[model samples]
Target: SFRFFQLDPDWISCLIDGAFSVGRVTAADAAADQKLHQKHVAGKQPPVVSGFLLRSYAVKGWPKLQVDGYKQTAQDEADMDGYKLKILRLAHLSPNVLLCLFEGDAVAVDIHQKPEMLHLGFEIPDTKTPDNYSKNLRKADGTDKDNYKNPWAIESIQPDPATRVVKVSQLFLDIEKKAALNFTAPFTSAQFALSMVEGVQKVRFVRSGS
Candidate 1:
């Protein structure tokens, strides 16, 4: 629901190139779990931007929708559930892109006849100590619910004219395949955009009845 207009292209370039440095958790977030806070302070791990997830929901009174040329197929299947895509605020940056700490399967479904919605789920390893401390420090809805074990779900809004929505799974796979071939070369934005387009084109829409 919040927007960051005209983000610096160089910064965006840095993000796509994975050139940014990791940051520490916020004081407010660290306050939620003391053990997690201690871990954060002890430099066990630093917060890093991971991946982004996108999904759509239906609301009453909104006009019929089309996303990336996919028309609204089921009017009665809008996502009315309380679950919302979690939005995170970067240190000094405005709310821009959704970030995840890990990678996992992306789930897509048509619910209540709304647009086909996508859910990006990150797979954080289960161990005595978790690598994704930020994920373990927040609730499912991206709120500070004092519960740290909730899974991450990111919903996408309509893409801005310049923004592109890509299938997370496909992009991940493409990146992996490319990395295997060019292990030493740095991944470029152009390559990422190419992967994104490939992924978006592969999404199949199915109409689920209300």
Candidate 2:
């Protein structure tokens, strides 16, 4: 029998990074199948989707919520801040994939156009636990606000199998919003799909309203 005791830092890093990417962290893990398969995360540890670029999806269990556009009728206008991007709850939760949903009213939705819009998306955090975010804030002195810049945004999250800690790396975004997302929230869910409008619906819901 041969025993190996050495660990390759580069290989381990790459392997974890790949797991996070393919895993799609930040998304919900509450689905029956996904939870059984991928929900083994300990504590607040959500599985990381991607690690290389600091972007990953965290999975959780949430109701079949509706991202009500309030009848945008138009597209571009719904992706802006002034736009009404609201999440309406449908019913009980189900085994579904919850991606980061963006909020847009009407004006912003109208302003955004296609082709370029496809290059935008949003980054939503799977969980909004204050401890998960605030615990990381503050310094030893507990008085240096300037030195600290760890603000909270709706980004994906991950859990370390080894350490069992969930963390947010980067906000989800299309290639275009990648740079801007670092400082702000990603685009709304509808905006993200329209930007990539393929099989996605113009206005959508995570799960069918039951």
Candidate 3:
């Protein structure tokens, strides 16, 4: 099996100059995926949905010239100070998807001839565990300081296969000094209808109340 990776111009130059070599490394946590191992044993291949690039640079001390493992030396600890960029595979889309909802007998929603507001969607974390994002950081020194946190967002929403019950865990909304409002019943029970609106796909969740 072969995989393709998009590289930067500097990396391309290094490859041409015979100064580039590749090494294989897997995350310590992800390597323990029992499901992935079971599939491998059964001669089944997993689909690759995306690829990530971790680019790291020095912040203070020079990079240590040694092998990386579960163990770390003093220089390895000190050299961990650096910045990293997560390069994600992205594609261009025009007339992006949006969500809208309406209820009751008749509700008039108008789209004018003026420019529409552009929306940027962020991918929410699927799991509450910080193990997934450990490699994304420049310093994977195994410390709480390097752990990822999403204070004002939904950590995960798991739907039970045996029942209609859906569980939402670690959801936070920071209103900052404003009175907190709760919509626990309707928000969880609200059903969304997804359809094409003006040639753009949308997921509309009609509100039960204001």
Candidate 4:
């Protein structure tokens, strides 16, 4: 779990509109969080910042999270897992997802919970090819392990962009955090699928658990 963040200080992956990054956490926590992108804030009023995901009106990147009332909450912190997020870019959508990035005033950490690995007993057509969140556990047969071939379904995808090589790493993190557990939320999984691939123009999610 080597969760990397704004290592350059000037770099921030935007959390969603109501989310903030959790800092000063442990490497183990960071590692676990990186491994699962799950985190909870432990303060009555924690400092909220932007995540690296941003859609600044000036460049190629993920959309930013909008914080309406930055300093009005008694318990200002949030369980990033507690809120729903969405990426408003229609152009970035595809039939097969590539990956997602966060780039604003955000700090993510790990939430402690024992999640069972869900087993969706079916195979996707192109499990070997990487979508936004696929882990390349390719075997000698050029196929992936069962888990890699089939991961937990994601609840929702927050659209962000990045040309960074590390983008895939971040995408994998997202899968562990969101998809592995609660895969059901208010989102069109079909639209998401269409958002990932090109030309085929349709998606109907098959049931699979992480």
Per-model TM against the reference: 0.15, 0.16, 0.14, 0.15
Clashing residue pairs in candidate 1 are: 55-156, 74-113, 76-112, 77-111, 77-112, 77-113, 78-112
Weakest lDDT window of 10 consecutive positions for candidate 1: 102-111
Task: Quantify all predictions' global Cα lDDT against the true fold.
Answer: 0.30, 0.31, 0.24, 0.30
lDDT of 1 by residue, 121-197 (tens): 33343476333212122121223222233222111222223544435554444444533223344555544333222
Model 4 C-alpha lDDT per residue in residues 1-210, reported as the tens digit of each score? 112122232232334211333652566755655444334422322233322222323222222212221111123346333432232222322232222233322233221112232222222334563333322232222233355345433222323445423343444444444433333543243323322322211111111220
> RMSD in angstroms, all models?
26.5, 25.7, 26.6, 22.3
Q: Where does model 1 exceed 4 Å of error? A: 1-64, 67-177, 180-187, 197-210
lDDT of 2 by residue, 1-210 (tens): 111122344565567545655656454632443454445532433222211010112112223222233323334643433435443222222234333222222111111123333332223333764223222211222221321353421223345657746432232232224332232343465433333222212332221121
Question: Which rank order by TM-score, best down to worst?
Answer: 2, 1, 4, 3
Q: After superposition on all CA atoms, how large is the RMSD of candidate 2?
A: 25.7
Off by over 4 Å in 4: 1-47, 54-122, 125-210
Give stretches of model 2 more than 4 Å off: 1-60, 69-72, 78-210
